[model samples]
Target chain A: MRLRLRPRDDSYYEMFTDSANNLVIAARLLVELMSDGADREAITEKMRACEHAGDDATHAIMRRLNKGSAPPINREDIYQLASNLDDVMDSMEAAVDLIGLYGLERLPKGIIDQIEVLERAAELTAEAMPRLRHLDDLTRYWIEINQLENQADRIYRKLLARLFSGEYDALTVLKLKDVIEELENAADAFEHVANTVETIVVKNG
Target chain B: MRLRLRPRDDSYYEMFTDSANNLVIAARLLVELMSDGADREAITEKMRACEHAGDDATHAIMRRLNKGSAPPINREDIYQLASNLDDVMDSMEAAVDLIGLYGLERLPKGIIDQIEVLERAAELTAEAMPRLRHLDDLTRYWIEINQLENQADRIYRKLLARLFSGEYDALTVLKLKDVIEELENAADAFEHVANTVETIVVKNG
Candidate 1:
């Protein structure tokens, strides 16, 4: 008797594909919000909007989990991955909200640079995501995503060190620390994506 | 054709399970450390040990992702969950580390109350975790775990409101906030567990 593998559902696969797309788009929006440098209120609104969209997508995935059969992989795993992606967006939005809410407009360049690193990480995550469905040739994307995540970690450490060592006023130090943490969180979310992608590739391949 | 759904051999699932257990144990230890009112250095060392254990578990899961088989979820979703779980631990550990590292000898009653909530949430999480392994009758565990998480959130809200109500000195306020956030973080970690368990139940049940 031959054991037949469960056929991968195209629609469920598509949901993940869309989730990856949303994350990439959210990352791009974050970068835009930074570069646009609009008024505080405007930036906050934009960030909030991005967060809302990301949340919708994440919730959609969760709702999907409840509404459909499990994907070829573990349902809990997918839910976790989706929630983490949403967290990245949530943290980004919160940073912007806190800045606007607390009137912290002047941020250090180093923190902004870390945000850039996060953007890059998000892009790498986006690139790695599609490969998960294929599970056949997963080496390149998985390795690159991990490399990007590690780079993000190194940047976080460097940023933290600079944050502590550099001379700044107490209030400035505090605000910058929060900003740096948010950026680090964004990177962490991306690293989660990389981690998940690698896991899928390894298990399925 | 009979479709056989074989369990994936990836080690991330096991690593995550171990991490879940470690987190619960850590919370219990933290409660002991706080209640014992040990010397600053002693409490710090114990907290560090818990943090180290959590870090090791995270590293193991990530390492498995990078080198072993792919995880059993959507790449994007897995990435998000793993990263968020790590963040929860990082934040919680930082809160405790700061306490000992900064020579905080006494925890306020309010903070202690919050820590109790966190400990309770962790306990609920540990209880819910084993259900994930067994696909049957898991929804009940998820529901109870989520209720515990919500209870923790309420404790956080009430505590934070009290903190900001002009009842404490500035330094005291800052430290209290840090501790509160950390306790809230442990609660957040359990929320993640609930989300994961719910998804698993959806899939298997």
Candidate 2:
């Protein structure tokens, strides 16, 4: 196949990469939130910045798509991809915000596993966005994301049961659950991004 | 403008109406759950059946879409509408299920206000679906839904503040929070459905 260069369409790939890389940063900040003696205020501020950056990146994609020049791929896939990435950031940022809002400290130790899974998933997603160009050798990306999501689901349910296990007071459990739910939502959002990529690949391959 | 005699396309309207009507029923079931001696187990089971019926209606639309005839509205609009309605059902059902799972009996009185908002939103959504054919009078539907959503947001925040008001024990607070969160999600999903309808009307009209 000849390499037909589409210069204008190339930036969509770059914007997606930029957007996903923002998630990597936010996920790391989420991990930081789990750290003892972590400056949560500062980390939350940084996470807010990352989320705004993500919003800007998503808007850039939308602005480009709305300019009416045909994209390199299906328009719906681009919209879905951008929206899913934004959703992940929103959930991550929400998790950080709730920690501040509820003045919660000393979270359950089990949630570190949840935050780490998000970090790994973000890493995997960031690695996969650039692969959209070739649309080949991409099977592993979505497959791994699916596996990660299943792992996330298990971790979330276990945490839920533990929250009800009478270890903590009701108020503490309430606050912790809010933060955990947001992390779970972010993990679910990551899988949505992968699904969009899979749809693009299966259609174009 | 004269209507095209697209007889086969008319059922799409029916399916959407059916789907929206199912929300109406589910929302009403949500209301019943709050009543005295409401048979919590029975209502959850009924809510489950309602959710399954909602899923079938959604699948029927998808099946017809996959049959490859062009839909009366944009294909994306059909998908967005169905998916949004399904999301509302999922949240409603999840709310009821959590009530059973947590064995929660006395909810915050404020939540009754929240449930009523969702009930009204569901009713408005069901009424608006049949109007998609002409796409008229829907300006009121979306606007009212937006207002309802704002109202729902207020009700949700008030409830949140109350939960943390140091009234209930921590464990009870945690359990009630889960059920409240799902109801809040249902209201948000109703707004999503209205947004989809607005998109269809604005684009086509």
* Candidate maximizing DockQ: 1
Best by TM-score: 2
lDDT on C-alpha atoms for all candidate structures: 0.63, 0.84
Query: How close is every model to the real structure, measured as TM-score?
Result: 0.60, 0.67
**lDDT (C-alpha) at residue A161 in model 2:** 74
Candidate 1, residues B95-139, lDDT tens digits: the string is 878786556666666766667766776666656544544555656
Q: What is the DockQ of candidate 2?
A: 0.15
- The alpha-carbon RMSD over the true interface for every model, in angstroms, is 3.8, 4.3
Q: Highest lDDT: which candidate? A: 2
The residue ranges of model 1 lying beyond 4 angstroms of the native Cα positions read A1-10, A67-70, B1-174
Tens-digit per-residue lDDT, A63-149, candidate 2: 899999888899989999999999999999999999899998778888899999999999999899888988867778877997898
